[model samples]
Target: MTVRSIVKFPNPLLRAVAQPVELFDDDLQALASDLIDTMRAAPGIGITAPHIGILKRLVVIQLPSAAKPAIYVNPSVVQASTEMIRHEEGSVSMPGVTDDIERHARIRVRYQDLDGNERFEDAEGLLAVCHQHEIDQLDGLFWTHRLTRLKRDRLIKRYGKLIRAS
Candidate 1:
């Protein structure tokens, strides 16, 4: 297991739609393992294939205090609560930038586990929020998409300035 580099925001890969895993093989499993290691090293709850420059539908997430991580291959939300919760969230892609976003308080997700077995589970609170956030990355979406247009514009400009500085 090893930590992998996270592709930063505004990178073409982050916007590129990812391809689905056609077959579950050793290589795919290794990628998953690497993703887990990277997420752990990041000390973060989630990481996606696109974040690592792999245009494949893959994501890993482990909440704080969770015993182990969970891998989601082509994961999607199957159910979501009508009630919503607003939480402050940040991402490695946009370092130092945090935003309050509204998301479903509870959600049921369907995805393949690390072993490639199909799994279905319900998640709430931070877990559900993290799941949705990572899954959005798979779809080439970001938490900023949920922000107000003015805030989104401000972020884009801020990121642009940061990019210019770097």
Candidate 2:
């Protein structure tokens, strides 16, 4: 397995909708493995294929353990709660920034396992949040987009100022 480099924000690739996984072959499996390795190497809980500049609907999440790391291929939220929960969320693409965002506390996701078998699981807490976040990537959306326009403008200004300072 190899660790792929994650593309940062403002990259056009991150804005592009990901293509669904069509052929479940060794190449696809290797890509999933690479995603897991990349997430582990970055020491983050989750990553999407678009983060690596691959416009493919794939995501790897290893929140609490290395042993039971999850690979979600073509994942989608089947159900979500109206009652929301707030959590401090960060991203590999937007390093050095974190923000509290409201998300569904519980969700049911339908996705394919490593072998491309269909699976559905109910997740709550961090897992649910992670699922929503990664699925957003597939739709070409990020956590920043979930924020208010004023907040997003401030974040952009901060990033621009920091870049100039550096």
Candidate 3:
């Protein structure tokens, strides 16, 4: 597996809706592995294919205490708890900025395993937040879209300054 370059915000591919994975082959497994490596290199807990300019519905997540990374292909939230919780959210594509985003406290997601077997899992807390955030990316909704207009504008401005500084 190779670490892929992450596409930054304002990239058209980041805004494009990702296509569902239809083949469960070595290539698919390789992409998942690459995503894991890329996410770890980003020092982030979660990442999506779109982050690397691949418009595929794939996500990789490894919580701080996780023993190994989790891969989700064509994941969708089948159910979500009404209880909302706020979590500080950011993205690998847009680094150095984050804001409180309200999301379901728990969720049931349907996705395919590496072998293309359909599976379901319930997630809560940070796991749920991570899944929701990554799913949004698959749907072409960046995490900042969850923020208020004022907050979103401020974050974009801050990110611009950071880019300029670099």
Candidate 4:
């Protein structure tokens, strides 16, 4: 496993939809481990395979309160709550900027485990937000898409400045 570099913002691949992970083998597991390593190195709580330029439907999330990271493959939101919550959200691809994006307060996601076992999970709070956010990434929807035009523009501008300064 390796700590793969994150694909930066505006990379066409970040906006490209990820294909479903058909094989649940050692290679997939290695990719998952690499994703975990990459996310931790990026110091992000969540990341998708697309973040590392691998267009596979895989995501890794390790919330501070969790004992370990959760890996989801081909995950999709099966259900969502009527209630909504506004949380500060960002992406490993777009560092140094975040915005309060409203998302469902609770969600039920259907996905596959490392062994290709189909499973479902009910998530709330930050967990729910992470699931939705990553799923959106799988569908080629970057986090900035949730922001208003003005906010998105400003955030992108700030991120551009950060990149230039670096």
Best by lDDT: 4
Clash counts per candidate, in order, are: 0, 0, 0, 0
Candidate rank order under lDDT: 4, 3, 2, 1
CA error at residue 137 for candidate 3, angstroms:
0.2
- Misplaced by over 4 Å in model 4 are none
Q: What lDDT score is found at residue 131 in candidate 1?
A: 89
Candidate 3 to truth, TM: 0.98
The TM-score between candidate 4 and the true structure equals: 0.99
Q: Candidate 3 — which residues are off by over 4 angstroms?
A: none
lDDT of 4 by residue, 53-165 (tens): 99999999999988999999999999999999999999999988999999999999999999999999999999999999999999999999999999999999999999999
Return the lDDT, model 4, position 142. 97
Expressed as tens digits, the lDDT of each residue in 27-114 for candidate 1 is 8899999999987776677888888889898988888778888788889899999999988887777766677889999999998865
| Cα shift from native, residue 126, model 4 (Å) | 0.4
Q: Candidate 3: worst 10 consecutive residues by lDDT?
A: 7-16
Give candidate 2 misplaced runs (Cα > 4 Å): 161-166
lDDT at 111, model 1: 89
- Among residues 3 or more apart in sequence or in different chains, the pairs in candidate 1 whose N, CA or C atoms overlap within 3 Å are none
- The sequence of per-residue lDDT tens digits that candidate 3 reaches over residues 18-89 is 999999999999999999999999979999999999999999999999999999999999999999999999
Overall local distance difference test of candidate 2: 0.88
Residue 157 alpha-carbon offset, candidate 4, angstroms = 0.6
* Alpha-carbon RMSD, each predicted model: 1.8, 1.5, 0.6, 0.6
